[model samples]
Target: MKRIFVLLAGLCCISCLYPQAPATEAILEAFENRSRQHLLHENEAYALTSFSPAYLFDTLLPAAEARYKKHPDTWLQVHLLRLRANAASNHRNLNNNIGIRPESVTLTEEAIRLCHLEGNDLLLAETYFDMAELFNLYARHEEYITMLTKAFEIADREGHDYFPGILLYHKLAGMCKAAFHINSYRESIHYGNRALAMLGALKRPPDLHTEIFVYDLVGFSYKMLHQADSSIFYYRRINELLKGRDTSTVFYKLWSAIANGNIGENLSAQGNAIAADPLLEQWERAGIGFGDSANISLARKAQAANYFRKGEYDKALQCWLFVFEWSKKEKHFTNAAAAAEGIASVYRRKGHVDDAFFYFRQSQVYNDSLTAFNNRSGLQAVQAKVKLENLQQSLANSKALLKVEKRSKQFLLAGIVLLAVIATLLYNRQRLKAQNRLQRLAQQKREAELDARKTKEEIENFVRHIKEKNDLIDSLRDKLSSDTALKARQDILEGLSEYTLITDHEWEQFKTGFAKTYPSFFPAMAARLNQVTPAEERLATLIFLGFNNLQIANTLGIGRESVTRARYRLKQRLSLSKTEELEELIAKW
Candidate 1:
């Protein structure tokens, strides 16, 4: 009887050590229930400060691990993996750092493998959505688009609605916001329209949270596009929605004030300050009462804009200057840029070119700072993607090796004496496969090299043709200078000069050819040399094509000294150091 009791106690201890399948399922279900609430409430600060997924992940980690060990290949293990990945991704999303992002990606990939194995489209869609957000936050716009596309396809094919559709809309809004930040207002409006259309197609209206977001994006996008009437239309929609609402909560009050403020700003922009002032005053009072400094600042800026439009120069200058200082001090870069631009405009109107130029440069500096942050994030995103691909390939190779081993074991068990022959056959098959792969890769490399060489030769030939034309023109000019037949020589010079002169159409054709041959060249050069003139761009292109000053002069029908002076000016325009070789820089570019 005592021995039976001991055996029963040991069994109970074992059961306690590893949670049962039912208990694991319960934990996952509870987590999913909480996830919906958390997703809704996940504002800017929620990820770092809230305790849903992060803390819950810790609490369930041991149980999940034990359960996964007991049922390594089950759906429950996939859920555990996905939950852990969510926790990791949330942690990474709180900051722009990519250090911890790869771990999250690994966990997500593991979950994805299980999802594929189990044929769970819903979970696969969700995983893709998570990864899309990860990519978007890190500035991997192309990857974000790809992931979202895949997720939407899966969800649509499987008839999964609501959350998947909402996520698609959310990412669309994010893309719009990103476009807007880069001054791509048309793209922002395009995306905003698409998102709004999608929201309208849903069988049910979106929750207030989602509706507000869409309204803000569409409204701001139109505002940025300078479509004041359209901007006011959307802002008024938000106002209509909030008209009967209780403003007891700070969230409601904040949105309410923002909507009112935007409407007033648009009205002011449309030259209706009388109508706008009341709404602006309403927003100002609400903002100050709610302690919303951003809303208050925007109202102040709008008031300054109104003053400027009303020809109250002193008040406008004072107000704009205050806003500029506040924006700089608070590190509100976008506002700082706008304020600087406004000051620059005012100074220009007041005939202060130097002050205008200085403020314009300041505005440019702030705007460039915003773009620089995006560029840094894009670099990190690319690095993270490369790391993920390497890790995933490694995992796939390991799985393939294990699968081959299992098949080999099955074959060997059929007959031990046949092992050597089977091993030789398998080795020969793998060798052939590898050889074929290598040959394909080698062929592709050769084709790419040949194509590059051919393109270079074509460009060189074109430049040489231009040089020949210039040489012919110079020879004609020499004849006109020395010939004794005055009338005939003068007529020859006129015709030859006319022949050498490039028309706008011909110049455009040449530029088109250049662009087609070297697709990335002009855009890259233009970005490096901001606001470069057409003449400077043409000179830079010629300089890039291994042209000497004399060759450039002949090609453009100018003197060699003129070409030299142009080069010097270009160096200054590009802010190149004296030690830097322009030719070498252009070559690399």
Candidate 2:
């Protein structure tokens, strides 16, 4: 009898471990049924990407809620709430709502509370991540960061293989990429690398979609940092990974075209415009084939930049004009502003000062419009108040006129004169306000132009000084080589070589000046700084300053072969491909 009791107790314990298995299975079955009834590609793994809110609200959420009500289980409740929150959030996003829905936040918070109450770390971490996603959708970045940090801490402590580890890192990478701040790109690359490492470490065949997205994010961050070789390397990796996949599918074609365009852009930036042409053309063709207007616009902009860099001013102007018109028509102020700026630059290069100034002002107008739109709430409130005051004043004027009319003719005439005076005063006030606003804008534009010219002059002066120093060193080396007693004066030669080499103090001054012009340069190089030797760092800096191999060798007091070897070693340390030019990479920096 005791043996039977022990066996029963063991069975009960085992059952307790999988208490919600049936409930989970039921929920999944309902989900599958609903997806089959509504989704066109129900059996596909990515069917949810095309999910409609109606399906979520009318079918999936309803079914999940019913199951939760029937089962009265905390796990089921949490699952249902998560689905509900996702549905609400998706609905808001699809409708292009200004902010996240309160219901979505509430549902996610309740799910989190339930998870905490149940002591389920995994569930709590997932819910926190869900909350983070909701915050991200609304661009509440601080809250998003907080939620993600909490989720990561919990997931790290729990040691979950995939739930929070891979997913959280991927989301963190994406978040950092979209942050649009200095150091954000490096942070993005850092997280993206981590995510990629985690994906590779997985025992199972990793999700290709997640892996590709992380690669794309990292590649884009590199591109923004002007690490062209690194950018192209990762983009090419995407293309390689997509091999043998269905070429006709939107997913395959979209990513493939994006990769091609990005690689071409990087190549063009590296001054390989001829090599980039075919790739850019392929990307543009794909955009046209897919009828994607945004992609077409982006491709045109990239082509314009390439042409502009290659001194094809006419071609650049044509492309910029097209983008400008299209963007204006679409009311995309940001693109319109960019196109206008490009147009102005092209005109300036062509020596069309008036046209350049006109376009510059046009760009400014578009920028101002964007600024106003971003602050539309306050502007709207101010406008509303002005309208209300005008209405109230008009009402008062009407009452006064009525009272004057009831009095004698003299009073009526006086009232009419007083009203005319008031009207004149108001007209003068509005005209003065308009003039003042225009004057302020004009002054701001002039100041901006002056500041830009000053910065350009300063950078030119700095570069010229470095070139002059290098020229002097080169001259000294030429004289030394021709010296008859050069072998006997070995100490003098060494001193000259030491003078040519940049000392620590000189390097500090160079960096300070460079940082003034390109503030993000060092920050972008921060990740690789620790790994590179001091000589390699100097080589990179010289390369970035537009120094050639001969000039770099002379500057460092080394032979050309030594410089080449150092460059090759640096390239390897940086993990660049053989075909990727180290010069192109460092010069971009």
Q: Please, what are the lDDT tens digits per residue for candidate 1 over residues 212-277?
A: 777787888798778999998988888888877887887778788788888988999999988888
Question: Candidate 2 regions off by >4 Å?
Answer: 1-99, 113-120, 136-146, 162-188, 203-210, 245-254, 329-335, 365-589
lDDT string, candidate 2, 230-263, tens digits: 9999999999999999988988998898899999
- How much is 437 displaced in model 1, in angstroms? 46
All candidates' TM-scores?
0.52, 0.48
Worst 10 residues of 1 by lDDT: 1-10
Mark the regions of model 1 whose C-alpha exceeds 4 Å error after superposition.
1-24, 27-51, 88-101, 114-121, 133-146, 162-207, 247-253, 351-354, 371-589
Worst 10 residues of 2 by lDDT: 1-10
